[model samples]
Target: MSRGAILLLAAFSGCLAAAPEATAQTNTGTAIEAGGFVNPLLPSGPDPWIVRDGSTYYYMNTQGNRLAIRKTQDITRLADAPEITVWTPPAAGPNAQSIWAPELHRIHGKWYIYYTAAASGHDDDAHRGIFVLENAGRDPTRGKWTDRGQLKTEHTGIDGTTFVYSGKRYFAYSAYVGPDSELAIVAMANPWTLQGKETIIARPDRAWERQGGRQILEGPEFLRAPNGKLYLTYSGSACWSDDYAIGLLSAPAGSDPLDATAWTKTPDPVIAKSPEQDVYAPGHNGFFTTPGDRETWIVYHANPGPGMQCTPKRSPRIQRVEWDREGRPVFAKPAGSALALPRPAGAP
Candidate 1:
């Protein structure tokens, strides 16, 4: 792809307007007369992340040049939410180009955003590292986002996410190790600084992870199970290829997160391309709980067809995640755009 094409592909997940509501289901599994929504929540959104704070939901994704956040009470009406441009990079410097995967998190009564960016004129695969912004206010969209600077990792990194385990915080991200990208973890002394040497947790060793001749593992997200099991879900394979999919690595909740040996990788992908549904390259996901905390949902991005090549054609889609008898997550299959699923429980 040309440089212009590459930039377009990287920055296409922009904000969108609201669509009409669809049919929804109630807590009793009965269909409501009105008020549900369909897939492709937005016409274009990649690496989509969402978090619910009380009655509000904050949504973000890769906007390329700057960080923007959409806040709403009803996720089905996300397109109608007011977007705030919280941060803009310098005219020329590190973290001034290719801003992607912006995640909103709250810790210690403050808000923080973990995202990836690179210096100007650098290739997307090179020079990219994780950077953070801190906001003192309780509402992330209403506060000033201060630059906390780039995270100093041993190598270039991206898709940085944080989780608290055993009363301590840890940062997990994808870093380049030799020819392939691997998932690494380090202790966090605070929301912005990483302590101790990084531990390599997972790599692209399986055939599904090495598709398109690109050995890659990126976009690590943390999910905690009800049984106290901690799982790190990540995107594998070359994202530009339709073969891209999601894989899982798990460790007990009490286990040392920095110990690479404690984590076990799933042999196959939990979610992959479903051509019958017209959903391809489905990965780079974030998890959220419904208003009543009764349901779990996965928010991620996918292309409607094969060979979409990471452009605006790659749009955000969501589906309720189910658990098997063993309590392990079961991401059935990617739902087609035409599938009229029930709206999220407790969503107005």
Candidate 2:
């Protein structure tokens, strides 16, 4: 092995030592008689998105053929949470295949799910687009998710998410621009429609983003810091490779989100592969705060080893996120799969 590989191996071993009691077994497979839990809140899942409403935490993931959500009081027990199928595409329609990255949001007291899907028997770039579903009921898992139709965009896109800033709602998504995929922003007329032209905010220009021969930047999630600054976190590089990681972009709180010049990109990845921790390609993350906003946590998916190739083996994991003295978010190195972590605050 190369000298650098050897050094990383040593580092991985050291991280394991700090959490010697960590285990990779499913929640039921291991007995938890303590205050913390091990890595991989679930046995198998990918592109995980989680949100907290009231006392319940609702989790969703890319299930290939349909949309399913898991509800629980404690995120550590996600593996034991009750999952319900909320939406299924028609047998042969524009959104009948390749469902990916479903994000649930509550706007104006109604639930909205923005997701990506391709037509049946079609996986081409032209057939993929963003779609929306609405649920008017109080509880997302128990309500009827009505089809809201496809969200119009300039080209093929995926990983759509929305955020409201300065009294105006905006949408950010990853879309195809020629041979490459880049992050774009636009104004939203409502939860399901985009107005005006998209401004390409972030492109895969850095070395890490070009890894695995697929210059991709997708999965844009919004984060607002306590200092009143707006930050956009996205996954970079090819998901099919171990180099897949998370990158950041920030803008002033009052600035227009659709203005590309208003945002600045991080030179390197924030959350990435930690060889020492045995976690690879940790990206496609979502953030949620504990009840009363006492703590913040990042929920994402990663493989146990290199070359896992973006399969269901990429399981969901969570860890607490910290902030620097300047109020910027600080994501520590990815935690090893066996590392024990405290459950979210106020979790039962």
Candidate 3:
């Protein structure tokens, strides 16, 4: 799609003026009373990661080359918020091709970003790895970012994310190991290096998986449950297939999360496409808390229609996360064919 069209779609997510105490009805048999957020917060692009720092929400996504950041205190305005070119690669290397899934993380009083960038013109060689950016400006919007090089790890990785448990830091990324594409993860000894060889933590072995001629799993986001278990939520099935959905893997707390052997995959998928909602390819998701810490949410992408051809069609979206009776993560279906979710909390 042309750059102009891409921007137009992105603007559609939240480009409307704030409606005053408006009410809307939906097929869900529920009424949105008013002052609630809408969906399809952004029109295009996939692999969305949002970070809520204090009262502000900063969002970034998969831009094939340059990094685009939207800063907003009131997330509902993210679609209308001006886009800023926060960081660009001065000299290209690992972070040049298909720059997919960029996430903002604040580590040790500094802003660190974990994104998947591959060698130019080589998508197969793509590794979702973590890279660091040091910002000196008191405000991220006013400061410049200095690229701190790439992190080293085994396997071709993408969707790099970091988690801290009990005082230890662990990095999680999605990669393929088998002859066919199967997603897995490994622990990092340090942010910049792999701890051990590597372990296959998750895979596409179920009937719901294996869409698009390949069984794939990616966009893994680690969430710690209230029960103290480490839940690694990832997208499975083919990106091009409407069957694409989210799944979960669980590892006990106080165990080695990096040790692939420690985690056990669930027998059934957790989140999948819902025809009733007309939502297809509802995966490649990240988790975050609202600004007021009132609720947890899932930020992901979906194709309004079936069959995923990477065009301006697939767009970023956000929804609130719910829990099952057993305290497992349960996500609802996409709102509808269009985007109507609330802006990220703290969006401008």
Candidate 4:
């Protein structure tokens, strides 16, 4: 790292103090009444995910014990969007509690939600894994969610996300591998089931990713570059650590996603904590575009201040993706929470 970059990272390594007012403000009654909006789209939301279907967007986040989704036509006004508690787990079962990182995706005209859950009585991270739910309705907020059981994997996993490349589909997730939680991918038999053996493509090999007292590479989200390059962005380090940031793993176009050697990890985090902007531990991200706008937007969660770590203090924030000559995504520093940014293009 450059001397300047090293200094910046050093500044964010500790828990700096911040006033509560520094947190992003929320506007409830007048949604999108202004031409711009501030960060922390909502007061608190972690492991945020959004999938656009038709003209509406369905948003989900980690809500322990149950799953809920927000329906919004204008994402800038997400605070005022209608939300439905889509599915609540039973009082006791394998997936009864510790609900986290729910992602809603539509495939074959049906809606599927993949999330992390564990046995109600278990406290070990070893017991935590990914599970799926299926809904056969046009509006996910108003449908019966059928439990599809846990996604079979050799290791415990979380932050499951699915994508299609060429003509086949694959499931990407974070699997617990010894001391490090690594990113893994597997072929899918259907929207809810993994078909083959899981392949560990990325690990917490860098110093930046070894923060939070544990090595972690979770929250796998995919993006296609302007060229044929493919990118898999994931959160590194523990969510409670100030060093938590995002890393990237890329593969050549048309390469087999199941082949572990095909993917390459970037040495530095593609995005990291912006202490200057009071954005701490910015990671666990997803992507979407506006109803008519083609510009890609990246959505994730972060703390407004230091020492907040892994609490409800983290909130959803977004910025447009930038690119370089090689078509690799370039992320600038996160915007200050209080500063107003143009409401996502074409919203409301």
Candidate 5:
């Protein structure tokens, strides 16, 4: 995509946080509604991510210009949580603009945040890459965040997520190396360092990926299913289209992440625009296990309406992670804003 088109995807998610009162649930002028609470724990959230550390949940999305996080014990009431600005880039630098998909991870007893950013004056995929920040303090919001520089992969891209398989560190992200973005993986020396060649695992070669007039394979999130198998779920299609959805790729429990043949792609999208469920362009998801009973939950962003597309109107919604009888994963049509469901299994 061109720079102008890509800016539409990167810029809007940051601005939506300013005007969240568009929905009745956001008004919060009255009681917590009769039957249940609403989806979109927050008004504007794209590529929504959350990491559970002890009793607290740290949340983030595409902030566009700067990096920030919201802290809360109960993610269902995230609108009432405290937002903290953890790191701000310099006015002139490669890691200064179009910040997106900030993932807060506590790796090796230290807090590290991985996010994508473009150059100070550029907004296209060429100038964008993944960067990391380190905070030694136990409390991430209060600590000093030091810039750890970019994760130098073979190609520059966005939405980088890391995982440890077989006791070795690996990084997965969308590489903008071809006609469209493709999911790539590489070995990581540590939390902030990359030390090997990137292997292209999946591409936007399937029909379901060519939505909104563009083929996209971004937002690679690592998942370890209850069945002990491994999966890499990624957002597909153009974010600017209502067809934007999620696709799945699976590998063995203990397989080589750097080998392309180890991963198998699902022909169709696992989750997509469900008008009955009032979720449009549903993509860019993160997973977490509940505090008490360890029920897995998915936190992601979607448009309330189909016409909203990839703009700031995209808000965060969540649901439980379900598995099928065969041990494969299942992503049902999400419960819309009208349905008031119970909080996650162990939320306080």
Candidate 6:
């Protein structure tokens, strides 16, 4: 055999032997088939964020403060994998406590963690901002992360993510406006600062957006459709209500995503709470591409029963994205009615 091939095979075989316990777990999440759909793989936490790096998957969520990290070659095993507390905030500061929506990204040969945090027990104190954590180590899964403080923006923001297009970098975030909470976006010159100005991207115009007594359009997530349209998805309504769901907006690829005028909001929500299956508060999601780009999947959080109490009951769930002929995103609920439905592919 070739020397290079032999070395690579030896390394993989060594990992399999060393982590036999991990390899032994084959589709253990309430499913009859191995690697099949299983919803609510994680029966706790919310605002799920997942990053698939090669065959490995790293996952996290809005656990209030503590930043948890789970690494597994197979995402299906994440349900049982122990989450390590990779980051702890300072004793006191703007990001001292109440961290939320932490998304990990590998940028410029370094690991960058984007998240929102605020002072303890203070909602008004919450700026809904973005902060960076850098890891210089080659393997992001094992590195010392240095907190880079908050991103510079004129207003409060959250659900921050970085996207690279046309050899340029940009940041997208969600925020509130006026008395009602709304999701918006701003172009960023760098990871730590917002450039130009903020643009009101989405609001609670659709019925699903106003699911509960209040209205909301937060958790801005940007993705390009197969046909090359810029699509933005946001969580809507109050998380305290079962009516909480997700909204969608779209525009041309070259259009200014930061310009409110350039984008268009769908009259109806693309994904919302599934009342039929008793899956409520289905929003705040992350997207991932399957190996070989064969499929696109969604990773989000939901309340299996009802109500919006953010506790151990609100766990992370995932499903595959089924697109319509019109080139829009359509979300599906897990099949079955007895307990919860099966999880989507690639989730634990």
Q: Which numbered prediction scores highest in TM-score against the true structure?
A: 5
RMSD of each: 5.3, 7.2, 6.9, 7.5, 5.6, 12.6
Off by over 4 Å in 2: 1-33
How high is the lDDT of residue 339 in model 5? 54
What would you estimate as the lDDT of candidate 6? 0.66
lDDT of each: 0.81, 0.81, 0.65, 0.79, 0.80, 0.66
- Please give the lDDT score for candidate 4: 0.79
Tell me which of candidates 2 and 6 scores higher on TM-score. Answer: 2
- Model 6: runs farther than 4 Å from truth? 1-31, 120-128, 324-326, 334-348
lDDT of 3 by residue, 202-253 (tens): 6677777766555667778888776676888887765766777787787786
lDDT of 1 by residue, 232-279 (tens): 899998788899999888887688988889999988888888898799
Alpha-carbon TM-score of each model against the true structure: 0.90, 0.90, 0.83, 0.89, 0.91, 0.83
Stretches of candidate 1 exceeding 4 Å from the true structure? 1-33, 124-126
Residue range with the least summed lDDT across 10 consecutive positions in model 1: 13-22
Cα lDDT tens digits, model 5, 10-127, are: 4364300111122234333232553235688888888899988888888988777778889898888999987788888888888877778899899988999999888877767678
Clashes of 6: 6
What TM-score quantifies how close candidate 4 is to the native fold? 0.89
Stretches off by above 4 angstroms in model 5 are 1-36
> Which scores higher on lDDT, 2 or 6?
2
Error of 1 at 302 (Å): 0.2
Ranking by lDDT: 2, 1, 5, 4, 6, 3
Q: Model 6 misses residue 317 by how many Å?
A: 1.1
